[model samples]
Target: MENKTRPEGFEQIFFADGNNLAKAHPVKQDIAKLKIALRQLHHNADLLIDAFIQRCESENVPVDCHMGCQWCCNQAVFASTHEMVVLVDYLERRFSPEVIAEVKEKARLKEEKLTELSPKEVLNTSLPCPLLRKGTCMVYPVRPMGCRIYLSSSEKSCHAKYDNPEDPTVIPKLFDFTLKAGRQLNEGFAASMRDEGLDMKEHRIEHILLKLLESPDKKNEWLQGATIHDNFPFDEV
Candidate 1:
């Protein structure tokens, strides 16, 4: 997918009125539409990655990441609430109550553990994703854009950074095309919400997860921009 054109009315969606934020109360159907649009954007990303992968293979470049290889999950998985809604909605339908409880507990613990660290510090730390089990992501269907674009050609480089993450230089080879597209769509959603006066800010997925887990009603408050993660311990969003 070369992405020569935006999805239909993407311009209208993105360029909606920012001053009219009071109008951004996205209903269930609107949110569903947003999720579908995101999925479409991700599909375009997949096409780009597939083509990129083929070219890399022609050049003898190997992407070491495969099923059951999830060392990257140990690092931070930050995302906008817009992106994360996909994960949470999917989990609610497919995950059992037991799994939901476990995930909540995990998010709470992670929130508590990382409360003292700044966002930058937290990024350098290795904390297993609460949704990763054994070596698989339970919510892979809705993994964030960051996860989608990150691919390692060398496991040694991944493990080295995993072991000593403070170095910051040891990172995987990420595709710019996918990252750019994902951000365009994700931030576009933010702008759409902001146009309606919604909370257009992004946050670490874990922090928002903790809030939603504690109170299901928080989602409405968050979308309305009436409450930030004031209850959240991390000062750095």
Candidate 2:
């Protein structure tokens, strides 16, 4: 995907007002389009993943995912409503009510445990995901797309590579195409929210999670603007 063409929707929001758009760094309309196109390129990532796996097998690249080594799961992950809806549905169908209650309680407890840290610190902490069961992801089959493409090709430190002393995992290969796809998905969702006039500026993981828990139907609401708002259409999880 090139900058010459982008999703029509992308331009609508990224260039909403002349003044607001001008105040920021000057990005030509075409360059801005590239951002959207870059995102759309990952829309069919399932196909890409299958291809990636085939390539990996042929090239002898080892993927380091296994039982009890879920470094990614031990973090405060966030998702768009689409991702949460998928996970919530899977949980409802596969787990019992007790399990669901347990997950929610754990989520609340984890929030308190990490409350004092900055949002980035909270997000970066290596605590077990609220849905982890005995060190395993309860919703592994339906886990978010972000979890699927983070293939660690080595045991070396990714953090150390960047000179970060606290880094625990090394991502020798992150499948950038997948990340591009997610960016597009999020941008598109944010664009849709803008079209519907929603605000999501201050929303963090907690805000989104609370909204999901309060009303699954709330997902239908428009999540727009540079901020997150509590209006528009949604479905209950």
Candidate 3:
């Protein structure tokens, strides 16, 4: 397949991140080693995002997203299996068993509701993210690329879309260049994992997290380059 043209100044970032992640791939079946690689990936991505936001500010393209902005949190979130593993690890280490159980139940309910909807319906539906609690992401620092890249230029536009989900005309004014850069960074890392013969399929955050949290062994299987979950619906990019 022909490669898509990357945004200006992002091609080098993509190659550098991809090469670093590919080289960081653990030679053995060790989850700690894998987490280290994932942490590096997140750190690099965050730096790029921070630079992008700075550029946007200098160019007068303001980003209106702020703390307590939960409008965007009421939408579907898709993440890679690798991200889910890191999230699971974080939850287990930082949260209590009861909190984890609550998250699982929330994810379970959302998954159940989502299973009955078509892809288009799912997109138009506004369901609160399982990770969102009290108007903040429970795992903000380690949030997936999809969540990190979603920056709106106007809070009003975001509110319109959130309040009028069925109205196709009500669209959020998101920063296109930021989105492209973020997605390419993620794709570059995914490409590296693909080269290592690992499964890089993306799924709804709640769906995949529920599966991994319920069956902890699946996380190890995935780290060892095993394709385990095949029945879950693929999150539309």
Candidate 4:
């Protein structure tokens, strides 16, 4: 479906922002600059999403998502390599060593479990994200676009889906326009990275995070045009 509620000229905005991001990091060594550029893109996307939420409220359209509402967390999360790098950087700077170690263990276990499941089984299973803690997301601020854009219009519907994930009859009422716009913007950013000769493949969050945490230098290697996590199984969200 198309983004009916997207702001006018959003396509142009996406193109320009993507090109600017590519320009911001001219060389492979500009990893820091790339992070900054990605952050700016995220910031801008948040503002746009907030505005859309407000518009929905003004129109009497209920948005059931809020802090501490995490029924949707018990599902697969796919993210780009760049997003994983930013998250790894955040974990290193903000979390204590103990917490990082715990996170790594959680990710490792989750990855192992996922590897044993078939793609269909993985989709039907309910597995909490490693970053989730006490009914909240530990990395909400720097979460991937996939997590950022998933919004439900009914809390009860979310609960129904969460409780009966394998029930094809149950479905959450989501904000389609928000998802579409957010995904388009993320694709624009990813396209920019690809244009810069970087591998912009998306992977299952747990698998990619485990690899990145185990070998911190993999981030630099990836930045230098080397591919990592190529063997990890992934499914598009």
Model 4 residue pairs with clashes: none
Q: Candidate 1: list runs displaced more than 4 Å.
A: 1-29, 222-237
Q: For residues 78-124, could you state the per-residue lDDT of candidate 1 as single tens digits?
A: 67666666677777789898989999898888878877787678888
Residue 12's lDDT in candidate 1: 40
What tens digits encode model 3's per-residue C-alpha lDDT throughout 161-221?
8999878899999988667766777777766676676777777889888998899889888
Model 2, range 1-237, lDDT digits (tens) per residue?
A: 112233344333332321132223222223233233323323334555667767877999765555666655655555544445445656777888788788777777776776666655654466667777887888776565456656555434333333432354533345565455444544444444333343333223334555555565554442222222332222211
Error of 4 at 58 (Å): 0.7
* C-alpha lDDT of candidate 2 relative to the true structure: 0.49
Q: Count the backbone clashes (under 3 Å) in each candidate.
A: 3, 24, 0, 0
The local lDDT score (0 to 100) that residue 212 gets in candidate 4 is: 92
Encode model 4's per-residue lDDT on 1-237: one tens digit a residue: 111233346665765665576576564656687778778878877887899999999999999898888888888778888888888888888989899899899999998998887876677777889998788778877898889889899999988988988888998899887776777777777776777778877777888899999999998998888888753343332
lDDT of 1 at 125: 86
Give the alpha-carbon lDDT of every model.
0.65, 0.49, 0.78, 0.79
Using TM-score as the yardstick, the better of models 1 and 2 is: 1
